[model samples]
Target chain A: MNDSQQNIKKNVLEKIRHGDVVMRPKIYFTLQVIVVAVVAVCAFIASVLVVSFAFFSLHESGELLLLGFGVRGLLTFIALFPWVTLLIAVGLVVLLEWLIRYFKFSYRQPILKVFFVAVCVVCVGGLLITFTPLHTNLSDTADRGDLPFIGQLYEDVHMPHEDKGEFRGVVVSVATSTITITHNDHDADADDGTRVVTVPTNFNTSILHIGDRVYVAGDMTNGTVTAYGLSKF
Target chain B: MSDSHPPYPTDEELVTRVQHGDQEIFGELMDRYTEKLSRYGRQFLARPEHIEDLVQDVFIKAYQNIQSVDTSRKFSSWIYRIAHNAFVNALRAQQTAPISYFDFDTFTAHPVYEDGHAERKEAEEMRVLVEKGIKKLDQKYREVVMLYYFENMDYQQIADILHVPIGTVGIRLSRAKALLKKELPVDTTHI
Candidate 1:
């Protein structure tokens, strides 16, 4: 309210009136708005995709630690989880919600409420998106080496644990720290592969009920495979 | 606000005129809000120099995106929302003076006022202390206090401007006052 400040403001207005500054063309603002909208939507979709990817990854990394690599490989596999994807997903969701805060209506509601609602919607959308054939289609595309980064990400997440030992069969026996699996890769043919493999696992081994389709990875010699990794196929 | 536009026009009508290419009315808006926005910017923004720039930027942006304005909503809230975003981004860009990095988490949790209802009193001394307290508070608290008292906006209006729930507006205001009451050593009524 000082005389000097008021004079400065009046001078600024006079300058504005006398064409010292020009308003941006209408199209520029329109384009800016359009770009913001597009970025917000893209951020939302990315969050959903990354969140779903994390979901599937978590589902695969069972709590049962198979002692095939003497817990080292188990530790590695656990660490190599789609954590980055999950983290990025969370970060994306937060970003999208933040962007939404700029909108007229979004600000009327509490941000925590907006954030929780946005997160739930994104998670549900991600789950529904997972049900699409896109996952399989993506895998197929990744298999042919068509997509680059996505292919690598898909390979890292979905490709069976081939780095160690890869075998799928049904559990025949369950011990305190070990589960015996009968290997049967080729069906309706002669028994060429290992007949049985004893896989040492963590204490939550009660999940290894006999007749369950299971996959195990470890050292296999003369049909005796000392397992390191185990998962429900 | 008139700028020779006859009797006062609603902000929505003025914005409509701008949308229809009557861009001069945008200046009317600039005239109306510049001082208010400047005061608001000073409350939370660390750099006082950027406040005028921020106000000018907000007007330019508002002028540009006049088409996107929803006529049903209050035009003042819409523009205030822009100012809020501008200040927030300005603060974020000021990495050298990183003030209250976690202020956004103000709405992430409980409404402390819900458990303990906050009383509304207006003491001249309290008001002065509140002004000093605003500068000392965190970004989130300072904003709600400024929006509530300085800008003379209600909780819903504050929520609309800040994009938070109305309840969050109350919680923030209450918590902000409590912090002020504690920090400024005002009459102690807040639990």
Candidate 2:
């Protein structure tokens, strides 16, 4: 070996022999792997739950039906979109990606590929979870005031957005050109929860029935809603 | 013509022994990797005087972190990874090139592929050009060239050491060659 090579080898071995440098215990690395794995799993679960809840909220709020109501409905859907939930989901996915990047399988692929794969997996998992009763049970818990901190998310889901010219309730009475609806079962006792909706001349009430859940888009002046768009969910 | 000595232990075997508390065996690893890492450091740091200290630091880190090495994988990759980090940190301290926080090359997919025969031929032809124009290339491109042509590492090994995608290694090498062509004296396109 050359003089320089000998010097490097001797200096390093001397450091090791003299205890200036020492190998970390096996448990240290083991714990590091375990912690990364746990955090990754936690972030993934949080991402899936947050994404699924966002979709569920949009559907239960009758906002999903707004997409079919034309431009105004589309605008309301965008305005009421759960941006916070979406941001949280994105953050969780990024955290998950950062955690998994240290692994061989993930590092072998392009970051975009890994990020795309993670997003797809989380979105699919979220959609699949929507089919389950998880959110339904959670919503019910929130309604009862038993849920901590997140109860507000489910509180106003069934309420009408008067400011946005959007209303959701159950049809209580139907006439030739008008329909009377009451706030969803949650506020049945509130005397002011009912409204009279005036439909267009060509509007069809043949598809309408009492007690059907419906969405109405119109201007509400006083206790009556001048309806321009209406649909039954 | 009988062989007098038994076959030497592989780097993986030696590392496994080191992990199992064979501290002295690290000296053997140091002896094996010092020259190789010095060459890597010299090419990467652009300062031959600093290579010995940098190589020594790499050995110290490798020895201290011996328990973290996975015996199933290549020990060369692990050591080279340490060396790469050390050299990059030194270069960063020197502010030689702007290595951004995010590398877009790794952020997206590239269409480049590694063909063994073609890569060997291209590397041979580009070696002289790379030696002449390497200092002008960016840090990100220069390191891949050093690892590929100078260290003789394959795309996957370079990816492991650099913690980048294999396709990234290919893209960087291709881009490095393009840059070298522009910076070199001859018309490299004919090669």
Candidate 3:
């Protein structure tokens, strides 16, 4: 070998023999990549969940329950649907893609390819998550006064409660202290319509009958409606 | 007399041997890449200062971090990627250029249109023309040019080294070739 070549080899060998650095095991980098991939997947799954809620809200329309909203209602529903949940879902997935840039392979990939793949994965996962029993459990917990803040959010999307203290429900039972009412599912406001209301200690309770459809104006605390005024629908 | 070795072992085989407690074999690998990688670094840096130090640093780093690589991959790509990063980081530290400022969002290069299959010329002339053309390109395109022409790597290999899609490798090469054709013109016979 030439002098310069010999010199390079000598210098390289010197560095290696110094013992100042250790070669990390290949498995550790592999594990790190695996961990990053798992985190990305988790972000994707969470994004799907947010999208599922948006799907459930769209399901709020009574017509969609039967799988036919007709053209006009469908158009209006699309126009008026609060898109925050879906928007947040999309934002979340995009953020996950941004996170993917940390990976050597992902950062080098075309943005379109990554984005398309991410959206597809999220949509498929989101649809499956939306159909799962998770939403049901959340709704149940929300009605039970367990979750903070967003608990009432679930109740509002799935049930019709008037902004002006009005609640519509079918009277399930009659009692002197409290009358039980299942929320009116057919009302335009309550899509799935499953919130239960206990109307308590109102003077108009004497007029309420079993199975009577009624509208009560009241404060809902822990999913119970306390009526200041009551009327028969 | 017939030789027991298969002329030269493939890079993958060499790596397997290295992983099997064969530290000495790594020097052989370094000898193979030293000249080529040094040229790549020189072209990238566009200056002739501490290039030997840069090349030596790549060897040292690659050796120290050898175990971190997924051995299933082509060793050359992994090492080249390390070299590429080292070069880019060194250049970026000088504060001249950020890596990716080109808006590739709208740029889609047509492979067939940019293919230079008809660009027939002598190897020496082609080499000179190519070197000049590559120097004129932005780094994004330059790396692809070097890998394709100087290193004689396939599109897939280039993709692996650069961490881009296989199609992206083709596209970048195509765009680089188009840029070259603009910088220097030539005539060729198509059969």
Best by lDDT: 2
**Candidate 1 lDDT over residue span B62-107, tens digit each:** 6655677778888888899888998899988875766554445445
- The TM-scores, chain A only, for the candidates as listed are 0.65, 0.91, 0.53
Query: Tens digit of lDDT per residue, candidate 2, span B1-191?
Result: 99999998999999998988889988888878887898888878756677888889988888878889989989999999999999988887777567686898998888768887888887778888888888899878988998889888899899999999988999999899888887776665456
Candidate 3 structure, TM-score to reference: 0.71
Clashing pairs in 2: none
Which of the CAPRI classes, incorrect, acceptable, medium or high, describes model 2?
A: high
Clash number by candidate, in order: 7, 0, 1
Q: TM-score per candidate, in order?
A: 0.66, 0.93, 0.71
- Our tally of clashes for model 3 stands at 1
User: lDDT by residue for model 1 over A103-162, one digit each (tens)?
Assistant: 656755556777789899989988887777767577667656776877766554443343
Clashing pairs for model 1 are A68-A227, A68-A228, A107-B163, A109-B164, A109-B165, A110-B164, A110-B165
- Model 1 TM-score on a 0 to 1 scale: 0.66
Off by more than 4 A, model 1: A1-20, A25-30, A50-80, A105-119, A140-196, A199-214, A217-223, A227-232, B1-8, B18-31, B38-71, B79-96, B107-128, B131-139, B163-165, B183-191
Candidate 3 clash pair list: A60-A191
Candidate 3 lDDT over B26-110, as tens digits, reads: 7888888888888888888766487778878888888877877666778888899889988887777665656564546323322
> Per-prediction RMSD in angstroms?
7.1, 2.4, 8.6
lDDT of 3 by residue, A1-233 (tens): 55665677778876666765456677877888798888888887789888777766655423132223234334534554657777888798888987797766665567677888888888887678767888778877776768787887677665543544546567888877677777645323434443355554436577778888765555677766666545565
